[model samples]
Target chain A: MDTYYKPEHLSHFASIAEGNKALAEKFFSYYGAVFADGALSVREKALIALAVAHTVQCPYCIDAYSQECLKNGSDLEQMTEALHVAVAIRGGASLVHGVQMLEHVKKSSM
Target chain B: MGDVPLLPTWGPDVAGPGLPAASPRAVRSLRSRGSELASAETQIETVSRVDLSAMPYAGSFERALRENGWARLEPAPIEIFQINLGKLCNMSCRHCHVDAGPDRSDEVMDPATVEACLAAIDRCGAHTVDLTGGAPELNPSFRTLVDALVSRGKHVIDRCNLTILLTASHRDLPEWFAKRGVELVCSLPHNRRRNTDIQRGDGTFEKSITALRLLNAAGYGKGDPGRRLTLVTNPAGAFLPANQAAMEREWKESLEREHGVTFDRLLALNNMPISRYLEWLEETGNLKRYMELLVTSFNAGTIAGLMCRNTISVSWDGRIFDCDFNQMLELPAVASDGSGFHVWDFDPAVLAARPVVVGRHCFGCTAGAGSSCGGAIES
Candidate 1:
């Protein structure tokens, strides 16, 4: 109760989700499929998951995916590059929206 | 084929000056049964005459490999040709297997041997050349070897101790290294100053930080294709490292915040209990426990990534070995003629076909996530 999140709480997530058993089963099955090795290796997927975790700012996912990336044999170089990918996208998304500001300035000047 | 200078035998006392010697009974037991002990222990007799009867395990490393379903531990095609340039290092760390120091100048590789090594590399067609030493840069012919390797488009790795880069004569090395596209793998035992200073020496962490800043200014570790910098870390204590990805994140954030230093990656390695580390373990009464820990934590998953499979190790005096650890212990690579092999007699096919020489110390490589020069084997 003193802390908002304990590391042990991560293991209990499945039980909590089980309250809605049918929905939980469906979600878990799909989740398993999403992470399986395909065109991208488990290592590559782990890196992607790590980037998305940072972009979304989820503490839980960040913790989970960090271990996953290492467990899949990805080194620090690969992980750092993946983090930069998220940073670039987030920064680029904001900067690209500046076209609206430019359009508004031209219209007002006219 | 000339008479090489005989290097000094680095005994336990030389490695750690104040450490007490093993008991008289232990020394006698090792000497009296040296042959049987050598066969059982899987390590060659200590060149310095330090009694190894104190080694906790009496079991054979070969037996463990066989019991685990391996016919024999064999080498794969050669890719990385690793050379131990010599034992002349500026800082003599307490746990160095090489027993390297500023006073180890006599052990350096001669130019003729260096040329033979280059010839071997050309013959083997190895894609990478990994150079190590007391401080490899201390070798007079080190730059010449690097230039030769780079000219041949070989990927050269300098296993550097960061503090060495701060030495007066070698100050401009960071720029020289970057221009050649050499992959710099610098050792930094920990991100924090306290642990690093304790393992290496006082003020070492500061010098390492300064050296890292110099490297950063030279465009190393800034996502440049040509300038790659890797930080190597080993635990300061008796345990295996925690997850590497988690540690890398911590290091990246701490270094950037505290020192504004950046590295391309971090490689967390395990401390193998050998030579100086073995002396420390014996003195601290952790020898038995550490051996037990290494043996018990052996993971089958790590075997596929064992560096000995793809790496060929050559010593300063032209002797070749299966790995650097074996090179330190003077265990030659398994040769068909049963004679010691050298860079001059280099043959990749022969090396790949021979079984790797395994000893009890090899348990260090298979424990937990496993360890190699490149870092962990099993993720």
Candidate 2:
């Protein structure tokens, strides 16, 4: 029922940043309760953390969880593989829009 | 290029980072508006490697909000972890926001730090692990990290650089990932080689195609069955990306028909201006133009679905950030006692609610088809 995200260090940060008050309180209130040594592995948490990072784009969370991914004993190669999913998604997002250009290009070329 | 208007709905004029030589009357008008308060500091500096003036006045928020209409909005956190291992990458693209390259070594994530990461994972009991790097494959402990997570039964994601797969050490990577069932996400920039290679590098397009073939042989990118492979795309300049569904169809058909390559999906991204991109804007005298475009395209839809609401970024050194772009700027993560903004020290609730610091560069994510770690701003 406990997690590292609920550490006292979090309180120190919340008090420092006016913006984090509500987020900190809400996240902490329910964060630790989610994992009460249920039918889950720490590796799953790393993956979930990673996905959430993309969902939010938190650099600090990415930095912290990347190492957590490894320490949980996730293999080196797999770590790269997992992270690529995020980069590929991020990078592909830009290219997917070339469609607007494609129609314009064809019409102009004609 | 389309039967276009003389003035694009999203175009602006500029000489450099800003408008050139404001007229006396214009300057007086600007001063009258009190926006001069923000630009007064911009005058003292030409372009410093680091500028504190741009740092938003955090102190004024408590005062300014009561005086105006600014109020912080908060969101809940989703349970998937996608960490940006570092900004260090093998390539320094013309528009790379993090300015990652072979020369960048400051944010490298080490093995010991990863051990701590593992502890957090176990402590959190998450079910998915997404690892990314400059070329995440370049991480010395990349394989170990993957194996560890797989051993724990978490789904693994790889932000692959297709060129890396061509390297001798990574030659067996396709098969290696196959064995581990790692989902492969590669950057293709475009379906056409010319566009991709030009933006990534001279040989990148060809190498990416080759890598796709290798992945296909490993059952990746094949729409038919087996493991998954995906490709990414983004506009080449400061502009909005095309529609996602239309582009994905074309990419699938072209890659499959031409190269016999297959992939599960295509992701479209919006390029934010930060490191190299900011430099690009300054050089091409498009900074103001780009900013205007971003403001013009600011979608309330994008603001509501911003990646920061659900995801949090971590630096290679185990620090925290609202997003990867913010990480490169070296901004503090929540300003903890003026110490370091490391993500490790923050409480999830407080950190999640914290109002994110925005900069001129944030325009990239807020522009048309807003971009973030999730590819496109779908909502």
TM-score for each predicted model, relative to the true structure = 0.68, 0.62
Give the per-residue lDDT of model 2 (tens digit) for B327-363.
6666645743444445355555556556776555555
lDDT of 2 by residue, A1-110 (tens): 46545444532654643677777787766766663324655555676677568657776677666655543334334556676777887778888888889988999995
How much DockQ does model 2 earn?
0.01
| Backbone clashes counted, model 1 | 1
In model 2, the Cα lDDT at residue A9 comes to: 55
Model 2 regions lying over 4 Å from their true place: A1-110, B1-70, B124-126, B224-226, B335-345
TM-score of only chain B in every candidate structure = 0.85, 0.77
Q: Each predicted model: what fraction of the native A–B Cα contacts (within 8 Å) does it retain? A: 0.00, 0.00
DockQ of each: 0.02, 0.01
